[model samples]
Target: MPLSARRLVLIAAACILVGILAGRFLFEGLILAAAGIAVLAVALSYGPGSRWFSPVTWVVCVAGTLWTAATAGYWMSVSAAADAAQEVPAVASTLFYIGVGGLVIMAGGVVTAAVLRTLGVRRISSAGG
Candidate 1:
């Protein structure tokens, strides 16, 4: 894909917004938040033109989103189990489910992103040729 100034700005804006949201929920300390912002800023700065950005973005996005989902799932499961069985098995179940679900979600996200990227490449190639 052709890297345009407009696209770069849009990607930067998106990365900044996502980084802020991730920081708000995932980070407990100011340093971590700052790190997140810095990482995102770099991603945005290099994304539009860099060959590595698309894959890196896809990997990070998929991993981050799945991590978020997994943590959320684990908390929810633990809450439900604590309310229900009050047993060690229930706690284990909660952990297992959360871990498995997170993995599945992460893999799914990667596959989905790969498909989208493939389609994008196809479209661009078709347009050019």
Candidate 2:
């Protein structure tokens, strides 16, 4: 199937929802892990020449990484604060890990996309020269 901006957005949204919902379940960690893997797979599926690697893609990836990181930090802080009064919820921990994993995967996807673009450019230049 062809990858488009709308599709990517939808995939990201779905992954986010999955992570949030799965955090409340027994298999939270496993479900979040699966979501992280799926996000990475979707990001990697885009080719260098595809619009999936456009400037908007970089913006989205960077924004997503930052958002996830910030969210993870916030959750960690809340967990720490709760340690004195009560045990932290499993959902909070699950969300924190999911955020971290998502951040890493998104950043990696951006770097990989840039590398692929560079390699494609080099290949084209060498072939034409």
Candidate 3:
């Protein structure tokens, strides 16, 4: 299931669409949607990369994807209601803040995990040796 360039572009378009549905601001949805895609990519690669990641990491990726998707759906509904009422809900800002905060923490964890994993890998042997 190698992704082609065209497929990647289409995926990016879809992410933007999902992002539009997920946030009060485009950046927020972009963040969450991008993160969701990242997690999905990791989960999909579990077979060949199994040794590099623990089972827990895989579980987290799957769970995170589910949570992010569900929240995006909620965000869509909120937009619908707000549109119908012709006024933004007072709580919408709070929702954005919580979403951004959680994404920041999750992003930090991802960076830290990647750093640790890279450090744990053994150095390659020189061809001359």
Candidate 4:
């Protein structure tokens, strides 16, 4: 796999970890740890001749993105609903920021992948230099 492909995969996996952590309401340390594992998995999968073209991989990537976005939406909605009860703005603000970040990441990944695929990849000759 190319570096770009690897990075893409890692990003997708990271989204998955974020989704899982958010849904589980895990502590910060565990969430970070899970995200790290996802990043490592993605990076390690990036090697020449690696079978990264499976349909299941694509399914997982798409599902992960959707899951992340949905999870973010859930958190944001809950926070908004509780705004009347809590005087502290920090909690709601932080949750909103995280949700926005997740949405941005998901959108960026989809757009980037689509653009790259539509443009297509070309090979450069290594024998010249």
The parts of candidate 4 lying over 4 Å away from their true place are 9-51, 86-129
Model 2 misplaced regions, further than 4 Å? 1-84
TM-score, one value per model: 0.38, 0.44, 0.46, 0.35
Per-residue lDDT of model 2, residues 1-129, tens digit only: 245744755776676677767777744443554455445545554555545555535554555655455565556666576767776665666666666766665666667766776788899999999
Better of 1 and 3 by TM-score: 3
**lDDT measured at residue 29 in model 1 versus the true structure, 0 to 100:** 33
* lDDT score for residue 74 of model 2: 53
State each model's CA lDDT, in order: 0.51, 0.59, 0.53, 0.48
Better of 2 and 4 by TM-score: 2
Better structure of 2 and 4 per lDDT: 2
Residue 43 error, candidate 1, Å: 13
Lowest lDDT sum, 10 consecutive residues, model 4, at 40-49
- Quote the lDDT for 109 in model 2: 65
Candidate 3 deviant stretches above 4 angstroms: 1-52, 55-63, 66-74, 122-129
lDDT (tens digit, per residue) of candidate 1 on 1-129? 335424645565665566567756654332233334333333442333346466545554555454555554555666566779765345556656655664554455545545666777788899999
Q: What lDDT tens digits, residue by residue, belong to model 4 across residues 1-129?
A: 566666766675776577556656743434444344434433333323345443433433544444444444555556566766755445556655654555455444445544443443322234344
Question: Which 10-residue span in candidate 1 carries the lowest summed lDDT?
Answer: 28-37
